[model samples]
Target chain A: MINEKDTRLSKAFITVSFIALFLGATAGLLQTLVRGGVIELPAGIGYYQLLTAHGVLLALIFTTYFIMGFLYAGISKTLGTLYEVPLKTGWLGFWMMTFGTGLATVFILLNKATVLYTFYAPLQASPWFYIALVHVIVGSWMCAFSMWRQYYIWKQITKKKLSPLFSFMAVMTMAMWFIATLGVAAAVIFQFIPWSFGWVEKIDILISRTLFWYFGHPLVYFWLLPAYMCWYVVIPKIIGGKIFSDALARLSFVLFLLFSIPVGFHHQLLEPGISHSWKFFQVVLTFMVIIPSLMTAFSMFAVFETTGRRKGAKGLLGWLKVLPWSDVRFFAPMVGMLIFIPAGAGGIINASHQLNQVVHNTLWVTGHFHLTVASSVTLTFFGISYWLIPYLSGRTLTKKMHKLGIIQTVMWAVGMFLMSGAMHLVGLFGAPRRTAYTTYSDHPQAAEWIPYQAVMAVGGTILFLAILLVLYIAYYLAFRAPKGETEFPIGEVEAAAVQTPIILENWKLWVGISAMLILIAYTLPFWHMIEHAPPGSQGYKFW
Target chain B: MPQLETNKPKKLKKAEKEQDLKGTLLSVMLLGLFIILSWGAVYALYLSR
Candidate 1:
């Protein structure tokens, strides 16, 4: 069990996260409706404004807060209670992040920062928005340091060579976050803040974009690794299986840390100013990151097969039938794992330089991430919430709540299928994303996209309903569920699993390699961009 | 010669523990095929465009 004091901190973070979910989902609902021509917004609230809120609140605030809370709980549970210093640090981080979120959110709501989540250069928001981002990143850094300190203390006390699997994964996630955020931190502090504040008259658009994406690409992994932690560490226990291999899991995570950061140029493959060679290089590294995902897939299937066979199941696929489909804890992440097949496929296509031409800046790209982060990652987060909330709150997930959770998951899957499916199809037909409802003066091709938009509207409405259900369930679990113990399900490794090599625990080696890769991948291209730098442009407030 | 003797039983033990999961093999193969097919489809589109 997690300590009572630590639970308070986790509960606070989760509470704020759910609040963001409600607000963000509401913004998402409005966006779909507006884009579908089902409704027109009043002049006071613009589509871009709602879009900004949707991205920031859900993609940034909800994920970060939820991840921090979940990591804290797992760390406290596995590494023992947080010491006074780290505990206080956790609280300090929580307040700062909350304050930053509040400040950034207020600016977005006022439409002063309608630059969308990427907040791409040449478009500027209030200086406060950038400062708010700084707070959020630094605040997360505080939590990351605290978790590391806790792990270090555990190692010192126990003198154990290997950290607990969950804590190890947490440190990996936070370490990657610290390294990845440096790019965005540099961009925001040096370029964005000063430019927006008029301390600088102009900004180097290419450098700013290069830096943002340096953070942006790995930012997705930061969101994804926690979900992976659940898949690798927690799901097997829920399914009555042992981890297929501790060494394999740690090795895959190590690979992710090394490969995920240096591949940022895959996002910039189409953007000019960066040479084709560098983009191609990053694309190759992006493919290298796929190795770990493939490893994860193999490991997952092996775990299921081994467990089912041990249960006396027979036949090639008999193991699938033995899985606990009725349990929401398993069902939610099970569906997520299934969705990731296509999501991972789509990611490969997106990073492919030539194939990216077919979908870049299109609704297909939007549809792709919706499948990945929204469906796969978000569903896994919800699965974690089902147990983590009740466990932290000292309550039980009653049968009724379980039923509701399943219904919510189904609703989400169906909604996503309609919305994201239509997006992918229509985007192939050249429908642009991030635009308000328009027939382009009734052009014939533009008219073809109408049906898909309508379908997306229907999907969005269902998704909004699902969001409401999730919120209600969160409330019920936190306050009304019967007082009882809920197992914080963490799986054990199989006895026959190979011993995790001590090299996997070597942080300096991994981080150093990661940094070296980033430098090699970026150094010359960055120097070129600076040397041949075009004159900077003053910020625009097109909104 | 000494190293080979020491590693011999270890290799056998490793092989013994490694189960040939036919279903997992087929599943991942199918996953790989899907990725290839999707990439090919998009590539064809890129070519056409």
Candidate 2:
């Protein structure tokens, strides 16, 4: 169990993450309404401003802070105490991220930075915006370093025994994130910061975009791996099952670390200047990353089947029926997996080079990501919050709250289905994304999108209600619920007869292989970009 | 007594293990089928366009 001080620190991170979710989700609701023609834009907040706030708060602030908090909890639990961690440095990281978030929030609110979440330059924000983001990333690095330090000390103490799976995974998550963020860190510090401050006359769009996506694509994995950690470690325990194969689980995470970063060019399939061969190579790598996910899907399903059958379930699909649907802990993440099926399918289309052209800038892309980050990732986070908040607060999750959680998850799914579903359909009809309103007075095609926009609005409304319910539930659990200790569900593997190989735990070899893969994927393309220098663009602020 | 007790439970455990393995293979097949069909449908949609 974590000490009180560590729990407090963890709570601080989680609390801020929820706060960001609330604010960012509010902005999303407004955008949905605006797009749906249900409401006009509120004064002083432009569409891009809202978009920037929504994306940054949810993607950057909410996910990062939540991951940090969850990892702290996982580390403390698995390592036997929080004292092994450098608590002072952990607190420092927390404050840095918090302060940086505050700084960026100010600029965003002031409309000083309306560059969308991508923050793609030559559309520059205030230099402080870039600087603020750097602070956030560096703070995250501090947290990652703290995990590394803790693991190092743990190994020193327990020389022969491998670290627990949860601790191993927590460290891996931060390590992968640390490596991935270096690309963006370099881009920000070297290029965007200087350009924003007027130290540079022009900035290279292609290089900046390339660098951003280099970080950007893997950033999804950063959000995902923690969720995967929860699914692998926590969900099986909740459902009364063991992990199918610990070796397979570790291998899957290792594969993710290797293949996740090198495939960013797939995001730029439509962009000019990058060689077609390089894009094709990256696309292949993107497909390779799917292997680990498929492994996860298989492992999870097998676990569920084993558990259900042991409980006396018969027939092929009988196992599904026996799994705990009433238990919100299992249900929420399970539903998340269900959504991920379609989300993963959509991802394949997005990665397919020729097919990608059809949906490149369309609302189809928006729909696809909504299913991914918005549904699969966010729902899992919500599921995690159900147990985690109460665990940190020293409170028991009530049955009533669990019921409410299930309802919230269902509402979110329904809303996403209606909204994202409509978005996908409309995208097929050629509706563009990133626009406040698609129904142009002059364009005949715009009229066709209005109905879908309305569906999106309705879906957004339902989702907003669901968000409100979640916030209320979280608040009630943290502050009002009766105090009690909660268990951190860490499942065992059923096939205990088969021990995970000692070689699988060799982080040094895996990291080396990951680096080699990244080098192979990136070196030539990066070299080409540098050698064939194009004239950089001057900063432009359309918003 | 020890030999008889251990042997009976061992037999039961083997049977249970077989059942679990069968269920796993069945689940995998279904999941694979779903994945292939979904991918095929999406690709076919794109090709049709």
Candidate 3:
């Protein structure tokens, strides 16, 4: 069991995450209804406002808080209790993040920051909105610094070159996060805040966007790495097996850290001003990410097969049947992994330089992320919650709670299939994303999209019901479940696994490589964007 | 020749039994196929458009 003080910290972060999930999901339900033309938003409420709330609250707030909490729990258990300074820093970070979230929520509700989650320049929000973002980013940095401090202290005490697998991965995630946030941090502090406050006459649109995507692409990885940690570490334990290979897991994470950062140009392929050659260069870097993803898939299958064969399973596919299918702990993430097959394929389509035009700025982009983050990442988080919440709350995961979790996962999967599937299909038909319901004055092309939008609403409604189920389960696990000890599952390395190389733990080497790659990818294009930049545009308040 | 044949087959069988990854291999290959097909379909759309 993790120490009591550490559990308190984890619980605080987890509680906030669930609260954000509830509010964000409610916003989502409304957006779907409005988009489907099933219901008009009331006179006071705007569609973009709800969309911003949905994106910021869930994509930013919920995912970050849950990840922080999960990482803290794992770090405490694996690395021994966090030291005094780091723990104090952790608390400070939590409060600041919470306060920031509250401020951001208020501004969104007041319609002062309906600029959407991207908060792209020229569509300015009130200065307080940008200030709120600063708090969130800085607060996350503090959390990152605190975890690094803990890892540093552990190395001193143990004198071990290779850190524990969980802690190492946690540090890598934070390091990537810390480096990635520098871009956004620079944009918000230097550009958005002054521009929004009228301290500056105008904002450079290309520079701000360039900076945002520098952080934006890695932000996807930030949400994802924790889910990968769960797969690489916790799932094996739940299934009564060892980690297939510790060295393999570490190598894959290092690959993500190195490759995921330098590839933001893929997001800006359709945008002008950047040269095609640079875009092609980054597109190639983006494809390099497939290496680690395939490695993960291979490792996961090998673990399952090896474990199943050891349990007396025979034949080529006999291993599949031996897995703990009925167990929610396995079942939920299993569904998530299954969803990634299509989700990842969609990502490949999105990143392909020429192919991006087919779905750029379309509902298809939105649908693709819904699968990757919402279905794959969020479902895995739910799976972790089934045990982690109970473990932190000093309660048992009852059979009833387990069954409810299974139902919730099924609902989420089906909901995403209906919604995201339609989004992908319709997007290929040239339906635009990020727009409110419109028929372009009942044009035939727009008329063709109506059925798909209705399907999205139906899916969104089912997803909302699943969200309710998640909240209920969380409440039960935290406050109402039978009081007992729930295991915090951390898998042991397989006995036959080879030794992990100490060089993998050499932070200087990895961070140096990561920095060099980012510079190579961005420096020239960024220079050109600044050298021949257009006159800055003043802020707009179209909403 | 008879002795060599018997030993080689036994060695191969033992190794396969000890650590079989054929299932994993097949699974990933199928995954690769799915990705290729999806990417191709979209690329075709891009061309037609």
Off by over 4 Å in 3: B1-14, B17-19
Real interface contacts reproduced by model 2, as a fraction: 0.45
- Give candidate 1 regions above 4 Å deviation: B1-20
Deviation in angstroms for A22 in model 2? 0.5
Q: Which numbered prediction scores highest in DockQ against the true structure?
A: 3
Model 2 chain A weakest 10-residue run by lDDT:
A80-89
Error (Å) of candidate 2 at residue A19 is 0.5
- Going through the candidates in order, the fraction of native interface contacts each one reproduces equals 0.89, 0.45, 0.89
Scoring the B chain of model 2 against the true B chain gives a TM-score of 0.60
User: Higher lDDT: candidate 1 or 2?
Assistant: 1
Rank order (by TM-score, best first): 3, 1, 2
Query: Which tens-of-lDDT digit does each residue in A106-172 have in candidate 2?
Result: 9999999999889988898999999999999999998988888887788888895577889889988
- Candidate 2 whole-model C-alpha lDDT, 0 to 1: 0.88
Over the full model, what C-alpha lDDT does candidate 1 score relative to the true structure?
0.93
The candidate that wins on lDDT is 3
Tens digits of per-residue lDDT, candidate 1, A234-304, equal: 99999899998999999999999999999988898888899898899899999999999999999999988
Candidate 2's TM-score reads: 0.96
lDDT of 1 by residue, B1-49 (tens): 7777687977765764565488899899999999999989989888887
What local distance difference test score does each model get?
A: 0.93, 0.88, 0.94
Per-prediction TM-score, chain B alone:
0.61, 0.60, 0.63
Predicted candidate 3 versus true structure: per-residue lDDT over A415-492, tens digit per residue: 989999889888989999999999999999999999999999999999999999999999999999999999989999
Ten contiguous residues with the weakest lDDT in model 1 chain A: A353-362
